[model samples]
Target: MLAILREITIPCFFTSYLIVLVLELLRLLGRIPGRGLAVIVMMTVGLFTHVCYVLLRATSIEGVEASMLATWLDWSLLLALALAISFFVFYLMRPDTIVSFFFLPAVLALIAFAVSVRDLPPFTRTEAVEVWRNVHAVSMAGGSAAVLVGFLAGVMYLVQSWRLKRHRAGSALRLPTLETLGRMNRRCLVISTVAVGLGLLSGVVMNLNRWGYVSWTDRGVMLSLLLLVWLLGASAVEFFYAPASRGRKAVYLTLASLGFLVLALVGVLTTPHGQAEKGAAAEPGATIESTTATTVIEETTP
Candidate 1:
């Protein structure tokens, strides 16, 4: 089983999803017999292989027992997996919709980014804080996935609203109702806020366990704090400010959240946010090892 999983490389699932995307595009041009079955088959294959790849990477070896979320490569791949699963669910729910056209691209982009950072060193974590780190990683990834869903819903809301105003409601291109999209966006915002808030709190616990103090100057920390603040503020507005709870205002809030998420991701990738030198353990007195790894940011945090 491990050998089979080892052979399931990025290209395996990537190609499957790429073919699925192409098939989806072709569906737009005209009808193809068995197209729906073909899409389901391809998506299933892609998802299976993607899950296998993630599971393989997430296994703990003798010395490298830290959670897979410690490295950018694995973290990005996990994020992509979450998005792919969401797309698969959405596709199953509305096979004729053009949502996959937008979703598959983001999945592919995340895979590409994972490939780009595949060589970076994984962060080290002690056994004591492993569970907490996993919580941090999973919550953060879930929050990110929710943000992406919200952004997509927001885009769909805008497009659907435009179509309605322009009398294109009866067009072949089908989408969810504006009200449905708004509800989805609102739900996603709430989910993202809660998940990200949990992630941030877990991160703080992990930091305090490992270093005894949190480095507020860390770029990743600052950006994450900023993101959490924005999410909280957006959620408050959507809850307290009745006018912003639905429609275009709600959509705009989600769009802005995506922007903040992008900036935070850029900071994480450009700096050693969750990563540390090879062989370093999360000991209270253990100092962080400086690395020659080239990144967009050269400054290191202790």
Candidate 2:
């Protein structure tokens, strides 16, 4: 892990990005062939290599700084790795799809963010604090993973909706059938919610019982509440009316939820002071001490 300039990850990223770009281009040019075992094999390998890079970075528990840069890079790596795992592992049960075209750009954006945020001075903490910090890191990473799945589901819904509305006949650019995308969307939504719930709950219990006075407030919590409200409201609407197709509603809800996520992220990145440090005029709520969730940006109104 000390050797960050490894050839494996750099070449692997190039290979993976190339495959995805080439595949999408072929589809756009109306020349995409049906699924081939060899193509999947190459994709799997490339995905594997990049994922290893993500894992290596994530497991670095020696020193952690709760600054915007560190948190963003860590969460992005977790998300990229999670998505890679999901895409490859699920491909076997599911049919081939070109959904990566939509997702890859986001992946690249996060990675670019990771690279841009450099030069963080490492901190030394007491053992208890270190243990608690790991707990918070794991929880926050888990939560962010959930959010990523939710975003993907939203994109899938939009792609499916566009195709149906256009009434386009079968073509290379044609996405997964509406039914499959809907199912996948539902799966992501459900799983993501479960993870969020687990992460949030653990954070609450750990905070409320052990250290109750350290509670903090910021835009992050507000945005999370808004997202939760949106999801719950959306689900209620679906359950009540049972729309003709969940596609449109799902798309709208997903886009709005993703907006909330972006807002929260921006709020975190733009803080005027140091990272989430205790006795630093900020709340400790930025990172969960004992859960699997993405850490919210650490800041107080001040």
Judging by TM-score against the true structure, name the best candidate: 1
lDDT tens digits by residue: candidate 2, 59-134: 4434222222134455556566556555554455454566666665666665666556534343222333344455
All candidates: TM-score: 0.53, 0.43
Model 1 bad stretches (over 4 Å)? 1-125, 281-302
Error of 1 at 81 (Å): 30
Angstrom error at residue 108, model 1 = 46
